[model samples]
Target: MQKVTFKIRRFDGEKSWLQEYQFPYHPGKTILWALSYIKDSIDPTLTFTASCRHAVCGACAVRVNGQATLACETLLDKMLDRWKTDTLLIEPLQNFEVIRDLVVDWEAKVERLAEVKPWLIPRDEFSKETGCRQTPEDFKKINKNSDCILCGCCASECNKLSSNDRDFLGECLRFCVSGK
Candidate 1:
């Protein structure tokens, strides 16, 4: 087991602190695993949010060494590689308030999706019994956005969303609106 140093930034409602930890890095080591190890055997004070250990759930997404990625999906090598060359700044995603450590206020991202009405507005007479009829071609037209898991990754990196103006819904809007 290779020891990897993790310098974690932590914040509660009242105060903030930095803590360094060391963990064993294996071939397929992930950021979530590192946090888990730190949380378990190490400092229980460190706090974050994670779920579904797979990338399918967005709950574990955080900025790893300054780049936004799902913690469960990103390999430790990638993070360590970047860290070795430069100091890895692991901060919560921009444009959101830090609830604690890596966890930030994610409600705003979901609110943005709600603002856009991401789902298709039903036409008159479209009934549940009938099920909104659509062919494969219709799906092909909107398939590009079908993969959206509401991970908020795009919003995390979006420059426009960082601005104070709340009107701009950001890139997810483009994805939602792009009917092609």
Candidate 2:
């Protein structure tokens, strides 16, 4: 097995530092797997957040080699090919508060979404007492927009938010609005 190094930027409440660790490489394993290995076997203090190891939960998003992406969805082989190296720099997503190793505070995004009122404001029903019903064809048209898993990947990659000049509603809210 080949050796892979993960250079992680760590933040505690008082300060920040870089921590490095190495692991055995297996083909087709994801960054999440490597992180889990580090946390489980190497260092118990290494903290990150994840649930639904598949891509559905969006809880495992972190910056892999400086790109905002889901850890479960990113393969180590592909990342190694892209960067031509065995060392991967994993960091918490940009444009948010870093809670620890790879977890970021999502309160700002949630608070912003609250301001936008992302819930459905139903249209008047054709049947006076019931809710409006959408046809199959109408549902199909907007189906792709509903695929958003609220991962905040778009928010981390947003040009406006990255600029740190003005606060902007993230793409997740925009996607919700467009879908409705």
Candidate 3:
């Protein structure tokens, strides 16, 4: 068995704390798995998110080191190694608000998404007229990013947030609204 440590941030609105956990590592053991082990064995009070553990769900996204990533898909030892120099920071994404440990208040982000109208304008109008065609070539262009689980990984990495600017809609929003 291998041991890896997670130096995570704990916050409850006004208060903040930091803690580390050493966990047993197995092949393909992801950050989510380690966290689940900690939650189940060490501290049941620890809070995080996980649904389909297979990365189908975006709920498990969190910061590893300084970059946002899906906890379920992030390799434990590798991520630990990546953050070994500094604290393996884990916090809720920025640009919104925090709900609890590793979770954010995304209500506003959802609201903004709703504001985009999401290509529905063409949908209703096109349906009333003749059929509109789309080719596989168009689909393949951004097919990978299209699978974005709303993880907010790309959003957290942008420098605009630290700079405190609201102009940038962030990558996730761009991915959703832009066709190309």
Q: Give the whole-model CA lDDT for all candidates, comma-separated.
A: 0.74, 0.83, 0.70
Q: Give the top-scoring candidate (TM-score).
A: 2
Query: Mind sharing the TM-score for model 2?
Result: 0.87
| Model 1 lDDT-worst window of ten | 171-180
Candidate 3 residue pairs that clash: none
Q: Distance from true position, residue 124, model 1, in Å?
A: 2.3
How badly does each model clash, as a count of residue pairs? 0, 0, 0
Q: In model 1, where do residues sit more than 4 Å from their true spots?
A: 85-88, 170-180
Could you report the Cα RMSD, in angstroms, for every candidate shown? 2.7, 2.9, 3.6
Better of 2 and 3 by lDDT: 2
The numbered model that scores best in lDDT is 2
Task: Please give, for residues 74-136, the per-residue lDDT of candidate 1 as tens digits.
Answer: 888777776673234556776677898888886766677687687877678799899788789
Supply candidate 3's per-residue lDDT for 105.
Answer: 72
- Kindly provide the TM-score of model 1 when superposed on the true structure, using C-alpha atoms: 0.85
After the best TM-score superposition of candidate 1, give how far the Cα of residue 150 lies from its true spot, in angstroms: 1.7
